[model samples]
Structure formats: structure tokens, C-alpha cells
Target: MRFDKKIIKYIVATAILALSLYLSARQIAFDDLIMQLQGLDYVWVLYSIPVIIASNIIRALRWREIHTPLSTEVKTHNAFSAIMIGHLLNSFTLRFGELARPIILAKKEKLPFAAVISTAVLEGGVDFAFLIILFFISLVFLSEPLFKLLNFDSVFQGSLGIFIIVLVVITALFFIYRYRRQLWQWSKSILPAKFASKLEDSMSAFVQGFVSLRNPLFYFKMTLYTILLWLSYALIMYLVSFAFAFQSAIQLSFIDSIILVVFAGIATAIAFTPGAVGVYHLVVASIMTTLYSITSNEAFAYATIIHIITLLVQSCIGAIYLIYEGISTIKLGEMKK
Candidate 1:
């Protein structure tokens, strides 16, 4: 019997959801975990507040840098509003924020969605470059025991992993260049005529999405901003490690925290669910367990708490900004055309 691809996707997604829940549960007993939380440092979590906000602020500035070549300049506060609300909207909805974020700026700031999306794509390169630098740096200083916890060492066994990453990146770049025209043609070829026209309309607005690499200053700023953002983020993660007073067995340092954070972020960026539902917990738990010798239960406690805190805090903050700005985020999405 034939089956629908959409149905298969949902089936697999559901399976992943189940797996995530099970793994999370094994890390902390439902009731015991709740009790453990009562003794936990709410204060420690608060310490992360400034770091988180500063990181996002830097990101907003970095975004502007990425978009500099496109004749669009976003003020920092305005950029923060876009970033926060977009983070909220995207957390709840899948991939919609990717479009919604640019559209909001395009409307309020009179920028084009294509230009903003261009900035996002251009910014992606900065993210890639920084992650490689941080990951490799961690690998150089860390021993096999510590490397297991950060999850970078396994990715390079017998040189096979390094070859694969290089090959994949090169292959991706080549195909992008090789199939540039065909990518558009392929989109047009598959969809119905009316839908194809709409797709073309959307694709047309993608002007600044990939061309921002032309200027050295723009790339330099992108790199600088990304380093700032990730470093701040890693600092927060390291603080979280210290908060427990029990991470001695985990054996992580400042740089090790940096490596783990980078790996977890990249893994979750490709996650099956919004906010990297399953991938975040799994990657984090594995890092703690393998590298730090953290028990699965303790790792889950750390991962789940961090994930929930980040989402709840940011989303609530973003919602307030949306209200203060006097625009309904849901309604903002309706203006997509």
C-alpha cells in the first residue's frame, strides 16, 4: 500500500517526541525532580538574565551589520523588538518566524523581507565560522575524557569525521553554485501554476539573503558580533555548571562550556521540533554524561531546566514588548502578503 510523505513525517516526528520524553523522564523522576527544584538556585538562574539580554542585544546589532550592504539599517531597540517577538513567535510556530521576522522589519522599518532574510543567510556563515573555531580550540586543549563530554571529539575519530565535514561543506557550496538557476526552475516545475507564481513572488524578495559577503567590513562585524554572542552564551552555560556545586565530577572548564554550547546549538538548529525539542535534551544530556560523567538524571535536570527557563523567560519578555509596541504578533503574521 502507498503512504503519504506528510503522514510519514508526522509519524516520525511523533516517534521522536516520544523518545525525547522518555529520555527526559529517565534523567529525573517526575516527583523527585520537582522536590529537587525547590532547593535549586533561582538566584543562579537570575544571574543569567543580563548575559542573555546582552547576548540578544549583540545579536540585534550583529544583524544590522549583516544587513549593512543592503541599504537597510535597523536601530538597536527596534532590532531587539524584532528579535524578541520573533523568538517568541518562532518558538511556538515552526519556520513561520523565519519569514515573520523579516516581514515585520520590512513593514515597520520599510525594509524588504528579501533583504532581511538575506541578512539571516549571510549571518549563517558567521555562525558556521565561529563554531568551527571554538569547537577545534576545545578539541586541542581537552583530553579524551573531557572531549567525550563536549561531544566534539567523537566527531573526529581516525580523521574520518574531519574529512566528512570538509566534504559536506564543499559539496553544499558546490551544489548551491551549480544548481542556482535549476533550484528556481525546480521550484517552478513542481508546484501548480498559481502556487508557483506565489513562490516566485516570495523568492523574488530574497535579495539580501545571500549576497552580503561582498564587503570585508560586513563579514568582520558579523564575525565579531557572533563571537560576542556565543561567548556570552557559553559563559551563561558555564555559570549553570557551577550553580549545582556538584559538577566536579563533570570536569568542565570555561572553554569546555563553550564547546558544549556550540555543539548543542548547532544540533538543535537542525532539530525535528520547534526550539529543537528532542535534539536539545539529547545532545546536552549526552555531553554531560559522556564528558562530565554526569548521570543521565542529573544531566536531564540541567538540560530541561535550562531549556524551559530560556523559552519561558524570553517568550514572556517578547510578549510584553509586543503589547507595548501596540501590535498583536498573531495579527502581524497576517500581513504576510
Candidate 2:
């Protein structure tokens, strides 16, 4: 029997998630894990929910800002609803949010899909750049802890390695943009007429997606929102730490939360499973246990609690928006096309 590619993707992703779950829990003592859970202060968990929601809202707002150069008609509510629904989809399917978000936004705002998609691509690039910067900063301040967590001989080696790769990529992209017309002409000379035209069309659509980046004001707003969004994440981490005994016993400071954010961000970037489920748990639990000398049970409990809170909150909000936007299964299929 023939299997669909998506079915295959899901199978692989699920297998990875299962392996991650096993690895994350293998060292934990279940009885101790339960005790750790029982001792958690629910109040701090409650406090984290709003901050989590606010971060996503901030992301939606920044997405709306990205759309401004193309179409000012995109409403904040629609943007929020669309991206939330996308996040909801991402929880179950790998990378589906990245694909579905632009379609949702385009349909809701009555804008061209290609134009809307360009903005999503731009948003991703911008977020990745910010993550790199934060990752570098975290490496500087928490090199010892990170080394302990990753068991690396020298953290700077990996940092510099990634920095070199990023520099190469940026240089290549700069040259590509600078000489786009000549490259197009060269391609047109060698390619079939129909293929060349299609390539040109795709390139034009991709370029249109980044129109907002040209505005200095957009950069200012983007930087501001990005800072606020990451800060909210760090804040949520801080609040959730209070629920764990380690917070009071060893005093995991705000810097500790920031450091954890860096770890979580790395997990998010490299995650292969849906919603980064098992990958996030393992990375976070590892960081906690390795850096703080916490028991495996406490570390896993901490990781699981925060992951559940964020997942539950985003999923619920996304479900509400999914209904509000009237995105039925049929529409989802159409968007996939």
C-alpha cells in the first residue's frame, strides 16, 4: 500500500517525540516526580498564563506591523486570531503553523496570499536573527552553566562556529539581493521561456513580502516588539520557577530564567517533532538538572509544568480563534494547496 508523504512525516515526527519522551523520563523517579508536582505552588503557574498569552499577542501585533507596508487593512484581532490558529495547528503538526499562518492572514484580510506569505518569511528571518543575538549573549554570561549543561569542552568554539556560518549566509544573501537582476537575466538566457517567467514571478512575490523592512520606523517597531515578546517569555519562566522548590532553596534568579530561555529557544529552533514536544522537555529538563544540581524528578516536573501551561493556553486560544474565523477542515485543506 502506498502511504502519503504527510503520513510519513507524522510517523517520523511521532517516533522522535516518543524517543524524546523516553529519554527525558528515563532518569526520573516517578514517586519523586509526583512529590515535586504536589509541592508546586499553583499561584505562580496561574501568574504565568497571562504572560504567555501576552507574548503571543505581542507576536501577532508585530505580524500586523509587518503587513502595514503591503496592506493596512489587516486588523489586530484578525492577525491575533490567525497566528493563534496557526500556533494551534503547529502543536499537532510539524511546521504547519508557518505554512498555515500566512494563508489564514491572507484569507481574513482579503489580501494576496503570496504577499502575505512574504511577510511570514520575513518575520521568521527577523526572529531567527534575534534568537542568534540572544543565544550569543547568553553564551557570554552563562558559559560555565551552558558548558555543564551541554558537556562541551569550550562553548566559545561552537558559538564562533555558528557565528561564522551566519556571517557566510548573510554575505551570500546580500550579494544575491545586490545582483538579483543580473542573475535573473543569466537564468533567463539558459532556461526555457516559461520556466524563467515562473521563476521571475516567484522571486517578485518573495521580494514583495519584505517591503516593511525598508521602513526605518518598521525596524524600530520590530525591535521594540521583539524585545517585549522575549522579555515576556523570560518573565513567564521566572514566574514558573517560583512554583518549584529549587527557586526558594537555591534562588534561581532572573538571570537564570534568561539563561533557560536561551536553552528553550535552542530547542525551539532545532525541534523536529510537533510543537517541539519531547525536544523542549528534554532540553529544559537537562538544563535544569545539569546546571542547578537538581534531581531528575524536579527538573522534569518543572519542564513539564511550564510546557503544559504554554501549550494549553495557546491551544485553547487558538481553538477559540479557529472557530471565530470560521476555518473549517475544508478551508484548511484549501490553504494547504
Candidate 3:
């Protein structure tokens, strides 16, 4: 059954990637794309390397803050290693990183696995909130173009409604889990004694993971770190644009880079393809061609180069970390079991 599920996930990821590639190719000529790739400026692209590394470091720091209130002994370097391993896993698998990240950290720190997983869940929620805020900011700046591209009136309204419903449901579940001991006793009146006992223990640790939120100062620090992490990402995007600008007619301001970054976030959220492969290229190329008046070939070339270089750099760094940690890809796959 587990093998079947893995196969199914791969199938879905392949389908999404194939679709995205088809969409992107339909808009660009292959020969033009090749020509653009050949003439690309390498220097400005190199500038994004240190920027990307800094972003990952900041992300590691932020994750440490989230885990600190739970276990003060959690080493920042260990957390950073787990994060890089997670990203490396994510490049090959669909969100397997979310599971592998906590497992790796829990094993290293001797922390409760459930509590570590809960911190990861909390981190995702915070990231989602940031994505929503950035999306709205992009909408404000590129209102007309986005509206035309996305039919924002209907799409945004529907998406907003669904987001609100999901938020409410999640908040209610958090509260219920927060009081799981009492709830477990109540459930024991009807549920099986063994099941209720197990559930109570699980819920307790899960809620304990969120104990960090009770510290208002920690919350503020986490928010600040999150901001810095994203700023580093935006800076990478801004710097990469200069590479394309030198070779093509694709000069973009920092704000424009933010808009593209927001689109990339949306693509990652919606598409399950490994490394957000084709989905990112399609979204970025479409936005540049439609909104910025760049040629389809130039836009696609820029998207492809930026995505490939970022993927290669991060994957290489992650691979080295995996080796240093004495972990292998096979071992990461075995983690799911």
C-alpha cells in the first residue's frame, strides 16, 4: 500500500510538470530560447549565490527560534543541517521534506517526534500568512495586470473565502487539541479506552510544541526573522534580474522582482512538481511576457536560467551537508517508513 501511494505521488508530480512544460513551450520558440541561453551574462547570476546562502542561514536561524521554546538544547547548526537535508529531499520528492525535516531533527536532538512535527506545522502556517500578505501587496501594485491575468474579481474572492474557512477550521482544531486531556477523558466515556489514551498522549506533545507562541517576545523575534529571511530571498531575485537585464530588454526594479517572487510562491503552493520545476518557469515567463512587454523567448530564458541555477546551487550545498552528516538519499527515503 505504501509503495502504491509513492507511485501515485510520482504520477501526479509528472503530470503537473508535463502540463507546465507544455504551456511554457507553446509560448516560446525553441531556437530563440537556445539563442537567449547562449548569450546569457554569467557574472550577475553568480551574485545570487552568496545571497541564496544567506537566505538559507536566516531561515535556519528563524527555525531555531521556533524550536527554542520547546527545547533550549536544540543546536542552531543541527537545525540548519536538517533544513538543508529537507530542501534536498524536496527537490526530488513532493513535500517529503516536511516529514523528513522533523524526523532528522528529532533523531539528532533526541526530541519528541510529534512535538518537532508540530513546530514544522506552525512554521508552515506562518509562511502561508506571509505569502498571503505578499500576494495582496503584489495585487495592489499590479492590480490591472493581475486582474486581467487571473480574473481577480472571481478568483480572489473565491480563494479568500476558502482560505477563511480553512483558517477557522484549523483554529478550532488547535483549541480542541490544546484541551485534549479533558477532551480525552470525555471521549473515554464513548471511545475505546486504548484509543483515547493514545490520542491524549499524542495531543499533549503536539500542543506542547506550540508553547513557544505563549512568549510574546519570542513571537516578535520570530516575525522579525521571517521578514529578514524573505528579504534575503527577494534580494536574490533582484540580483538575478540584473543578469538578464545586461543581455536582454528585461530590466526589472526591486518591486517587480517582489511581484515575480509572489507569483513563484503561488506556483509552489499550487504545483506539486519536484523543485517546482516547470510550474515556476511557466508562471514567471507568463508574467514577464504579459505584464512587462518582454518577448516570450527572453522571458522564458530568464525564468529557466534563474530556476536552474538556484536549484543547482541549493542542491549542491544540500548534497554536501547530507554527506557531512553521514546521511544518504536512501536513508532519507527510508525515513518515511
Candidate 4:
């Protein structure tokens, strides 16, 4: 990894956060926010435990949908173990679990690495599709008119713009799914440099990892799982919101939860940090305050609580499984063998 790039990215991210606080602090009550958070009944945080854990179980079942067409099967329990452990690790390294997940399962279950990895990619595609749909739905609930000065809606009103965007994405996704190997070869041919050779091989493997999604049923199942997984996520948020009387009129409402999830998804998609780290906090807080009219402290408290609860629940479960599998961090080297 490029240490310099990594350091620079963190510094940039921190700077963005500082700017966010500076801008919001003038309008929001910092002290009140803190006091509100202090006054919050922490028992509500605990309520998230079951919801988050249940979401993971549903996630495992959903993942099975992605791999069925590839003929790469994994038991739900096994998939759950791999998913949790890989995601926990991914919290420290952006996109790391994209490959780590299948590799871990392949090692443990004697499954094919390529087959498992391909299924993971298929799952990702389905997740993206649903997220996009959710985002569109959120826009309707918000139902706010554009600034009008920009005439942005006029520009995007017709089918042409949507068609072009859809066309580009479809074209890119198609090439990636079908010609991944050839594309990798093409990249090498164009670059054809000595240092690029190893990088090419690694990337080729990564692309090849998604080839199993080529099957039609893989797409179908991936679709089903994506919608359900996100629905499960939103439901958990709703339950958590109710646990604390988060807000009756605005905060934690059904539509509000959907909106938050949509914004969080958009923000986290481009977040380079592990588990989106500061990015998740910033986006969730900003949206809650802006759209839901939540107090700054209330917004921050809810976001922080959810993030911590989700992580702790996952970590605990993954820790137990790690011990059961006899795969401690120190022993991870053995898995690759």
C-alpha cells in the first residue's frame, strides 16, 4: 500500500470534518447537543443489538441468492461466519473484505476461491441497484423543488439524460462482467511496463472473481437479496428509533429512516475510509439535523449509538466464530496456505 497516499487521505478527511463542525456549530447548539446526548436513555442503544444481529442472519441468507447460479454453495451458518469476520476486518481496510470474504470461506469449506469471490461481486451489484432505487424514493419524500435558478430539473426532465446515464452504467457493467479478462489483457498491452505486470495479474484475478455473475439466475437472486437486505436494514433502524422515542413528528419516522439510509448509502459509497469511519458519522449527522430537524446533539447521539452498536454486535459474534474456527488473527497466515 502507498503509505503517503493513505496519510494524505486521512488528513484530507479530517480537514473536511473540521470544516463541517465549524460551519454547523454557529447554527447548532453544541452544549445543548452534548447535554441531550448525556440525558438520552442508553438502554435504547442496547435495543439495537437484536436488530443488528438479525440483519446479519438475513444478510447471510441473501448472499446465498447471489451464489446459487454460480453453483458455489455455502451453508448459511458458514456464510454468516465468513461475512462477519470479513466485514469486521474490512472496517480497518477499505474494500479489503471484497476478496477476503470468499478467500476465508474457501479455505474453511474447501470451496473454490474464484467461485466464492464471484458470488460476492454479484451480491455487491444487487446491493447497488436497490440503493439507487431507495435514493430515488427518498427524493420523492423530500419532494423539494429545485433551486429553480439552475433550471436543473429542466435539464434532467426528459428521458435523454436518464437514458444516457443508464446506458453508460450498463455499458461499463457489461464490459466489466463479460470481458473482464480481456480488458485486463488490454490494459497490460497498453501499459506493457515491467512494474505493471504484477499489478495486472492481481487485478485480473479480482475481475475474474466476479465472472460467476454471468449467469442469468445469479442476477435474479442477487436482485431478490438486495431488496430484502436493505429492507431489513431500514426496519432495524425503525425499531431502534422507536426504542428511544427518537422523534415522533420528524425524527425516526418510516420515511425519515429511508431517507437517512439513502443518504448514508450515497455518502459511504465513495468513502475511502474503513467502514466509512468519519464519513458515516458526518453524513448521518448532517442529514438528521438538516432534513429531520433533529437537534445537533440528538443527531450525533443517534448516529454514534447506531454505529457503535452495529460494530460491537458484529465484533462479538465474529470473535466467537473466530475462536470456534480456530482462526485467531495471529493464525490468519495459515488460512492462505
State the lDDT of candidate 1 residue by residue for 32-104, as single tens digits: 6666566566677778777878888898888776666665556777777788888787676655666666677
Superior candidate under TM-score, 2 versus 4: 2
For 1-337, candidate 4 gives per-residue lDDT tens digits of 6999999877976776566545434455768667766776666667667768777888888776555544455678888998888777767665566666777776766656666676676677667778766765555444342122125565356335655787899999887869977876777787848857767655555555465556676566666666666766776666667544456555455656767777678767877666666667777877776655666667776766676678778877877887788776655555554
Task: Give stretches of model 2 more than 4 Å off.
Answer: 1-7, 142-144, 147-153, 188-199
**RMSD, model 1, all Cα superposed?**
4.1
- 165-201: candidate 2 lDDT, tens digit per residue: 9999999999998998899899899999999898788
Candidate 2 lDDT trough over 10 residues, lowest sum: 147-156
Full-model lDDT, candidate 1? 0.72
- TM-score of structure candidate 1: 0.81
Off by over 4 Å in 1: 1-14, 146-154, 157-205, 209-211, 248-251
TM-score, one value per model = 0.81, 0.93, 0.89, 0.76
Question: How accurate locally, in lDDT, is each candidate?
Answer: 0.72, 0.86, 0.81, 0.67
Q: Which residues of candidate 3, in runs, are more than 4 Å off?
A: 1-6, 141-144, 147-152, 155-163, 174-183, 186-196, 246-250, 333-335
| TM-score, cand. 4 vs. native | 0.76
Ranking by lDDT: 2, 3, 1, 4
Better of 3 and 4 by lDDT: 3
Q: Candidate 3, residues 1-337: lDDT per residue as tens digits?
A: 9999989877877988899899887868899789877776778889999988888888778878888867787888888888878888888888777688888988899887788889988888788878788887777665466766667577778578868977898899889869976876677889788987886787778877899888889778878988887777777778877766533454577777778888888887887788888888899888888878788898888888888877888788878888898887687667656
Candidate 1 lDDT at 222 equals 72
